[model samples]
Target: MMLRGALVPGMIALPALAAAFWAYAGEHAALSALAGAATVFVILVVGLLGITAVVLGPAATSMAGAGVVYLGQLILIVTVVLVLRGVDWLDGRAFALSAIAQTLLMQVGQVVGYVRARHEIHPGSLDRGAAS
Candidate 1:
């Protein structure tokens, strides 16, 4: 569900990031921007999948497990960025911007999911129709 939520945001962020890089830094920077987006996409998906398989799957429905998974993923993301920062193929500014944006949007999606989930689990708790 988290991944699904990110789909639309990714669609929006990626193209905008690309365009921004192209306009500000030219074709080479645009390439780096796309690469940065792809890298983040792969990292998040794989990290989430790993977490799902290892912790979330067995725990099933446990929010604590999800939190742990997210913490781990966050650490992994930071580590990856630090390690790859010096790579020649990566445009540092573009990579930093896109990665940061992607990560922030993912966090926002998670929060929204949590809110919707809380509402679903308790129906009328968040229902605007209740006032009608």
Candidate 2:
């Protein structure tokens, strides 16, 4: 589910951001932006979804273990971002813009996905009992 939600936003943001960067900047910038966006998206989805699986699976039997997993994922993400920042091939402006855009879009997609899911599971005031 997390992957599904993230995929929608990633698909929406990547091409749009790539096109914008290409028009305003150049091929390198566009490519860098797309790469950065993809990296961020993968990090987010994998970290969250992976932890979710662990939590739901037999590996994480307690909330404390889940918390530890979450912390580990955060550290891994930060490490990746820091490493990416030092890379010579990265375009700082495009990378920053793409990261921000993709993150925001992911948040929006998650909210929409949650609402749609909630409505599907149980029709409330917002859903109005409408058919999914």
Point to the candidate with the largest lDDT.
2
Indicate which candidate wins on TM-score.
2
TM-score of 2: 0.71
How far off is residue 86 in model 2, in Å?
3.0
Q: Which 10 consecutive positions of candidate 1 have the poorest summed lDDT?
A: 112-121
lDDT of each: 0.72, 0.76
Superposition-based RMSD of candidate 1 using all C-alpha atoms, in angstroms? 3.9
- Candidate 2: minimum summed lDDT over ten consecutive residues — where? 118-127
Model 1 TM-score (2 dp): 0.68
TM-score, every prediction: 0.68, 0.71
The segments of candidate 2 whose C-alpha lies over 4 angstroms from its true place after superposition are: 54-70, 119-132
